[model samples]
Target: MTASDARRPVQLEIAVQDAAGARIAFEAGADRVELCQALAETGGLTPSAGAVEAVLAVAGRAERLAVLVRPRPGGYVYDADEIAVVAADVREVVRRGAGAVVVGALDAAGGIDTEALSRWIDAAAGAEVVFHRAIDTLSAPVDAIDQLVALGIRRVLTSGGATRSIDGLGTVEALVRGSAGRVQIMPGGGVRVEDVPAFVSSGADAVHLSARRSSGDTAPSGPGGGASGFDVTDGAIVAAARAALDEATSGS
Candidate 1:
């Protein structure tokens, strides 16, 4: 870590699905909000331009807005058409006043798809570009950090090759040591409020989570008429995470 980075407090980035979530994150004192759609269904696909505008309106002059640019809900690998669609989406989102764009693409060999990344970066038109958790799908996540840094990626959100950031603490720490302040390393995916301290101590630049709670309102659906609830950003959880991050990074 650089001297400046060391003195800076760890950041909290919340993955939000809508304007309400963005408002909650802002009110809870989060450093940034990653806006996406179908978060509960598809692990976060790209949100609509209207959605981005609404969130930006809510974000206003406070929170930083980073829009997720995943074109579809499957793996990171994408065909030419999908890549083009992703690039277009990136352009649209950046045009809509997003401060950053979150994206990920992998080659069939399970490595970074530099080709697709270049297109998306070009489409970003100098807006901050963040590599999402798809880095965890690589065999050499630590090594991929070097590649992303080389590609001018501003930050990478990863779980250190594990499904949960807590389980991947070792790899996360290793990535931090290897980053050398060139690119930001953020541990995300299954991050809980109680795990904030451990991540803060890992020397990560930031921590990402979806401090979400189900809105217990059920709807009458076909087939399986089970009581299904939708997920929303929980203000209480965001506050707790903000407090935990503050307490953990206090003595720095």
Candidate 2:
């Protein structure tokens, strides 16, 4: 087989905050799901042990599941105590049947915290490890990519230092080229249906998205115009993304 032909097929990974969302994403053809909590507020937090078990129970045999291991949100930098919490959470999720754990940690200088990250990686217990979007916050992403590859990270999810992958296409493409197949660069953040083909064309081996939509389950307004209920994953959106990825890869 040709070198390119022998490469693994592109994949679509959906980030879902709960079991209901997990079911929708899976049924709609998601190849993998990153299970987490408080997506609206924290981007994503480490899901409870029970939550991880419940999502895995409903996943299909073909669908892989990864759990985010952030103890809390806000930032990727963590103190020693926080690092301990992250390590504990990673072990808990793996024990609960997660096939992989999504994690990242930055030092005070805004670079990959290799020391802190090592603890979580060791806690993964042989499961796949994906460095999360904290890569985007790095002062030098290319340099960080080298570090992660050396550390044996399977993939790095990033928007190429932009708020959206489409806006960062050039950087993402550069990252793909720079990795030289040593690591997979998965573009994420505000990925839309129309953007999938472009991302695939840019050499992203995989893509991540939330596929979230308003479920019309609003909460009562408390005080002054506060945030409403959680947005659920839309099966239609997930299906469309899957179809888009299929079309992109098939046409290539």
Error of 1 at 122 (Å): 0.6
lDDT by residue (1-252, candidate 2, tens digit) is 234433348899999988898899989999999998888778898888888888898775413898888888688889999999988888888877888899999899887899988888898878888998898887668777788988879888899889888898888888898898999889999999999888888888998999998778677767887677658999999999999888777764
Whole-model lDDT per candidate: 0.89, 0.85
Clash count of each predicted structure: 0, 0
**TM-score for all models, in order of appearance:** 0.93, 0.93
Tell me how candidate 2 scores on lDDT.
0.85
Name model 2 segments beyond 4 Å from true.
Answer: 1-8, 61-63, 221-226
Model 1 pairs in collision = none
Candidate 1 lDDT over residue span 1-252, tens digit each: 244434467889999999999999989988899999888788999998889999999888423899999988989999999999999999999888898999999999888999999999999999999999898888788988788988889999989888889999999999999998899999999999999888887889999999999987677655876447788999999999998888777654
